[model samples]
Target: MIIPDWLSDLHFAFSHRGDGQMSFKHADKDVVLESRNRFFHDKGLNLDSVVTGELAHGAEVALVTEADAGRGARDRNWIEGIDGLVTDKPGILLMTTHADCAPLVIYDKAHKILGQAHAGWRGLASGLIESLVGRLKSLNGTGPSELHAWIGPTIRACCYEVDRDVADRFPDHCRFLAGESIRLDLTMFVHRELWRLGLNPDYVTDSNVCTSCNPEFSSYRRDGLNTQAMACITGIPE
Candidate 1:
């Protein structure tokens, strides 16, 4: 429950600790459920107040109003075909899962609107961050300057090597390296996107922890297909 100082004002949660119930340490279902429950209880929210699903690594954004709050997490409904969630509703948590992929959490302080995104190579190449910011602006009339962003733990360029095809998908600005073997700085790319959207550079924070490089955190690129994922959750207090 002790969020990093960078995002303290934003009412958010993240885990370096792997969940035990989720099969994979990073994706332990039982651990995630327990964490969600604890988050809701500690925040004085109902179990039905958290919203999340099986992220598809796409650009599809789910608009969560009060009605949809907590449905997926509590009901165990399949959140198929979606990669992001946004809401202005209080007490409703927006969550996303990741191992090496970065979890980007955005908040509009003035409007109390928050967004959670799953940004991997595909989602980042697809401009999911821009789309999510645009959606938040449309829903709450809050501009990018009013938003605060946090980029969570992910595979850093030092440890993340991609093929040319996958690396080339990003624009020149987003690409950190290019050669027979390429390294992509996903956290930096997301930060660049936030700046492009007009959010103040000072307001953005990066965890700077690389999953692939750190043994304490889970890493699919290092651990292979069976690695677990960490969940990043954020919301407004009731």
Candidate 2:
């Protein structure tokens, strides 16, 4: 697991491969719940206080409240059709699952707002980051400059080879060409998007850990259909 030091005051963490799978979709429901509960408990948190996204790989972002907690903790009843979740309430954790896809953790410290977004290739293409920032702005009056963000571990450009169709969606600068293969730097794309939205580049931190290369992370590209997932959590203390 990674606990970033960039923003010390907020409660944030990205689970690693050894942390066990948190997604119940492909694993046993009871086992997934047990692992999730243990993980939260170890961090002095409770599964019941976490609001998870449905991870539809879309651009939708939702503002959750304390009442929405535990919506996806033990069952599949996640916040439907949303890939991003944000909350300003204390003690309410926001979580999103990821494998090769990057997990984004955003915090508006000034407003005490926390958010997590699942940014897969499709989600990025659909402008998930923009949707998330827009939600924070509209609901909490939090601008991009007021936010600090962390791009969690993901399949970086070194291992993110894509087809011509996927490469065409992004700019040339975000693509890396090696021999005949085209690789996309999702981390860079996210950073540029955040900058375009008026967020200060200094406030954005990338873990720089590639899931595909690191044995400690679950990578869909590496493990294929049998891949599990890691959980990303962010919140305020009670």
Candidate 3:
């Protein structure tokens, strides 16, 4: 589990498969508890304090609160029709899962606001990034410039070949024709949108580590293998 340096104070972690699959999607809820306990043991958080969303691959972004904590620790919290979650509350670990899609993390220390989002191709096309940024901005006067963002490790254009239908959604600048197929670059796409929305280029960091190409992370594209899921979590620390 690695936390972005800019978000050093937060209880954030992007876990790889070796860290133990931090998921309860199967019948064994203990898998989630055991994995989370080990990963966050001395970090002042527990698996039961986590709040997660079922990735719907849409643009719906939900606002979580103190009461929403522990809703999905053992059982699915089931926030419907949403692909993103935002919160101003502390200690409640906000998380989402991904294999190929980019995990988007955003924070505004000035307002103590934080967000975690899953941006698969569907979510991206549905305006997940813009919708999330807009909603966060509307709260506490948080603007793009005030927010710091990290585009976590995901399948890059090198591994993300798509059909014309999927490729046509993105502009030419965001994709290129590679042989007979088109490849989309979510990192570049998000960075462009962030800048267009007024975020500072310096504050936004794209790991540029391709999950499919990098051996450190898991990739569905690399094999039929799932990541145990990349556990992307962000929150305000107490």
> Which candidate number would show the highest lDDT if scored against the true structure?
2
What is the lDDT of every predicted structure here? Answer: 0.73, 0.86, 0.79
Give the poorly placed runs of model 3, Cα more than 4 Å off: 1-4, 25-33, 42-44
lDDT of 1 at 109: 78
Which digits, one per residue and each the tens of the lDDT, describe model 3 over residues 1-238? Answer: 3345767778877777677766666326777667767777745567666778888889999898888887666677657678888888888888887677889998987998888888888888888998888778867675678898989888999888888888889878889988887898877888888898888988887777788998778677775644566677777887
lDDT of 2 by residue, 42-94 (tens): 87777888888789989999999988988998899899999999888898888
TM-score of every prediction relative to native = 0.85, 0.95, 0.91
> So what's the TM-score on candidate 3?
0.91
Give candidate 3's whole-model lDDT: 0.79
Off by over 4 Å in 2: 1-6
Residue 73 in model 1: lDDT: 69
Clashing pairs in 3: none
Candidate 1, residues 118-179, lDDT tens digits: the string is: 89989878878887888889887756887888788889888888777987887775556545
- For each of the candidates, the C-alpha root-mean-square deviation to the true structure, in angstroms, is 3.2, 1.5, 2.1
**Prediction 1 TM-score vs. true:** 0.85
